[model samples]
Target chain A: MGLAKRIIPCLDVDNGRVVKGVQFVDIRDAGDPVEIAKRYDQQGADELTFLDITATHDNRDTIVHVVEAVASQVFIPLTVGGGIRQLADIRRMLNAGADKVGINSAAISNPEFVREAAEKFGSQCIVVAIDAKRVSDQDEADKWEIFTHGGRKPTGIDAVEWAKKMVTYGGGEILLTSMDRDGTKSGFDLALTRAVSQAVNVPVIASGGVGELQDLTDGVKLGEADAVLAASIFHFGEHTVGEAKQQMARQGIEVRL
Target chain B: MRHVAVIDYGMGNLRSVSKALETVSESAEIHITSDPKHILDADHIVFPGVGAMRDCVSELRRLGLDDVIREASQTKPFLGICLGMQALLSYSEENNGVTALDIVPGQVRHFDTQRERSGNDFKVPHMGWNEVRQNISHPLWQKIDDASRFYFVHSFYVDPTDAGVIAGTSRYQHEFSAALSQENVFAVQFHPEKSQSAGLQLLKNFLNWDGQS
Candidate 1:
């Protein structure tokens, strides 16, 4: 059958607790990762992503434990990102119960690592996360530059070109996040998302700036993204995963409703 | 409690598969191991695989688990996922062609890159959730709905020489075997572990199955 569009709820965890302060019903006092993950699984989330914002050696073990605890209960594929630099780190994440590891800054520092990781672990598990922003300079009219270190440092590299190169280097999926629209609640940068999605043969997950259910639908429809990833919208309880899936399903976009 | 052993050939993600099986059944003890004896002794055997073919085949050969798997599939309730399912076929086109176990008398075929349906492009690795249509009744499918969506991330699919063994079909560029059953052995191309509720139901069914059909 035709592949269904996915609605992914991103959880940004700092240290041990969810950084966004996502509260689980009754279990709010516990703040247990497993409990929160179980809630999402029951809500019919196509997938769940855990971004360890701490990304420090001190918190790596804690995050690994979190991954293990959540993975043991949640039946969906879980992707863990942040602080993943080398093959050993990727191995640690995978062995710690992550289905896929999203690599961003490390990929920029050394693109060869992408090829190496993809070679060791299948391409299906290597996700290259690209944070991009529109370049408004006179030099380039239609250009988006890549950013690193949590969208603080801007790299002169063209976003679309880098995406194509990542695919060539064997990256299985691209998590394209529009930094300009990230927390704006305006919606996904459809132009940016569409450009990257068209450039890569692998699945593209559009992240950032999802305010409502329609934004999730737009990610698949206008942006041509295979999946949509939002943090604040899902984490803050602004909307439920079921509501997003239902909206997509009503729009004739195949979602796990 | 029933003991279920998931064969680990040092490839793919076994954590999700093992955990999902654990979540589905409280009566079954799931173990992920490469040891042949443990695999052979389990009440049920699951062969989960991913990554490249050459590496997968080589690891299976290195561990000598191929023989163990062959022996186990003949007697106990056996289940295979993705590359695990592909390895059962006679041959696979991945990695410029590699020899497989030939358990199901079939060839693993790659999706045509140039093929696209309704003008929409057909991407390889087929990574996403897709609807699976049940073609025949099987123990593993008990309590699961007819057209449930399951997560899949694979490029090549099995083309069994004997269609009678095909238990389920899913459309990508065209219809392909989503699940295959032969006697006591059942295998699927999609990751039931990542398929949510329907998947949990299928795994629960497997836990309770007697390996008769």
Candidate 2:
């Protein structure tokens, strides 16, 4: 089979509502998660990833219902993350028709969960999301650190090495998000993306800093990412999947138009 | 009233296919039914799939819609999309020690990039738009232009034993058949619903097809 380029729109659901932000600042509501998901699915989005970014403390049931509602209407793959701390959470999400479950803070807090989840539900079901921030100091040159709690805390783990380890521990895929470039509209962190892509054998989705079509092209061409994920550009009507695929085709990147 | 019963075998994308049909024929009644009687009574049938070929074929068997589909195909119109198209073939390499619907005399094989060194840069599953080149004309291609883009997401391609059934072709690293039509049977590797205007037009032609008449 040929490698398929996936175009995913990340929905940051805060308390059952979809929101978009940069560096977790200037947060603005987008729309209803179920409504937006159906619209994206109609617009030809390959997959949908829901990140419960509200720092869920007591609203787990609401998020689960949101996932269930969206899954019922949207036939495509639904991936749920955010506040996913335990195997039970993963089970709830999967039972709610989630094809995959993404774990970021939980995976870092206890890396064993990644392996255990893989063993229980199979390797192709668990995804380890790595939110990384670039360190600028010359002494810390070429270093990428993992961030937790919605990019609020640094995990002190090297992004590339952590990604390699995640795959080794049976993590299905790696979602590499560049916190520094996120919401900057500059582009994906190609350096970090390339490092992780080369370090891991599994598929890597390049997220953050996608403002223009070229950024997507760069993510696929230079970063060697399996997929290019964006929020604002797709959410705010800046570009559609058809337009993105048109641009990817111009750059010779295969995308389902 | 022309009714198109889309067999919902619980293994395919029925909504998108139904929506595409709705766009084509205003009177096209799309029923997502697993009942063999509904399929046998329908004027036409469309099988849309996305998942394992074995599971899809098995679901059709478990539901006992195989004979109904075959019977309808002999006298009415039949269209298969993606895995639905693959399911119509003899067998697939996905599930070991299994047989497919065998409606078409061919096997589905994985896209061999290593044999042909041209698709090294492009990944597998080939999810995107590639131009469809017409090899032979069928009613489905009535209004569609040559080289019109269509959406496709599949890892394997169909290799039919009967070359005359090949109706359309597309290329990634190597050229392969994209659409096939034999008698009343029509199938395409691409998703017509997701293919936009060109795809909608193809669906429209299929709705207006007077093959039986």
Candidate 3:
């Protein structure tokens, strides 16, 4: 009746190469971004997200080349993240063929930057990625706080309220990641996902902890996420994007097959 | 080699559009230009953009492509996408009120965003893939199945005064015009370059299309 729920396979790219694990991607020359991107597109991935994990500033420009190569061939939406702090950085990524550029620490450091970016580029291309973990110790803690530096630093900003503010500042979408369950292989923080999703009118992309196929459906049906993103499962060849769609379809969650 | 001009008015991304055209076009030279001469000299015209309509129209007028677009739509295989499609309307509700190219009698309005009575969570900007039902048969739809899902990421939808020009419709809050056609022009709200197989086919059809009904 409406838009289909999207499945995005995120590739952590460092200096122009996708790296999840050394042994996971040996089949097709492992780290080649173009090859991995092409394979995902062929498997019917709705979109592709390249999280630039490169450390140095000079090496950061490498992601732009990676985005350009993949975007030239793959005809789906491409979003690039990591080290996007200024307007020039956003412009560089967009000009290099990225459909959207994600803002993480920069967005938290200066909230006005979100408004400026939205006013300049339009909110459609601005995505604010939030890393959050539960603050309360009680079972299924209801209170969560924002974390920066990949969940190492806590900002004490309430996750739900921050999501609303980011959207108000003209962020088109929110990439909410549950730091508590990121590598646990358990599932998305459904409680955290629902709280933020209900508080905001924009689309929420659930990230961080997806171990299997059912977790994808749970994020949509239970967590109320507009899209689900994962890296390891798809990167290791445990499941194809096609298979994920079929699984969600079986669960009666609307997906593009 | 056929020359195709992608009108760039300093708004959104034209890189993907040109790249996609280059990928599908057979011996056709794709040129991304804002100049009037390049656009006027081209055999095919592809107008594409994103962002606000006020800026889109202002920039089009600033670059003087408004007249060029109007002129090209009459005698060439012209295609418009996203903000480019909205710019063809008479006016848009964005930025208070902004007048458009007036090629098609229509008004672009922001999504009502009125939560459906059935309790469906319909969001604005309507970002994602949605099914587009073909309202009329057109050459640009060649090799593409009807009601196929296409990538869309816009907050406003077009309402043409003349129903005949509406080539396609898609339901978001309610059914809205997703594609429009007039004589030699075809425009869409969705991004064909980003719609994968279905989108690629639409672009391929446009490249091979002869300016005929």
Query: Best-fitting candidate, measured by TM-score?
Result: 3
Kindly list the per-residue Cα lDDT of model 2 for residues A36-78, writing each as its tens digit. Answer: 8777777777778898876658876878888777765565666
For A1-257, candidate 1 gives per-residue lDDT tens digits of 37888888888777877766786545654356777788888888888899887756776788888998887877788899988899999998898778899999999999999999999998989999999999876565678999876678999999999999998898999999999899999999998999898777788999989888899899899999988998777766778899888888888987777
Off by over 4 Å in 3: A22-27, A139-141, B114-118
**Candidate 3 global CA lDDT score:** 0.90
lDDT of 1 by residue, B107-181 (tens): 999887665432344777788888889999888998888888888989899999999999999998889999999
Question: lDDT score of model 1?
Answer: 0.87
Once fitted onto the true fold, the runs of candidate 1 whose alpha carbons sit more than 4 angstroms away are A24-27, A137-140, B116-118
CAPRI-style quality class for the chain A–B interface of candidate 2: incorrect
Q: What is the lDDT for B83 in model 3?
A: 91
Write one digit per residue (lDDT tens) for candidate 3, span B41-160.
Answer: 999999999999888888888888889999999889999999989999999999999988899998998986667523445677799999999988899998889999999999999999
Q: Summarize candidate 3's per-residue lDDT along A156-193 as a digit string, tens digits.
A: 89999999999999999999999999988899999899
Sorted on DockQ, best first, the list reads 3, 1, 2
Error of 1 at A145 (Å): 1.0
lDDT of 2 by residue, B8-111 (tens): 88763365577557757778788878888888888888887776676777788888988877787788888888888888888788756358888888989876
The candidate, 1 or 2, that scores higher on lDDT is 1
Interface RMSD values, listed in order for every candidate: 1.8, 6.5, 1.5
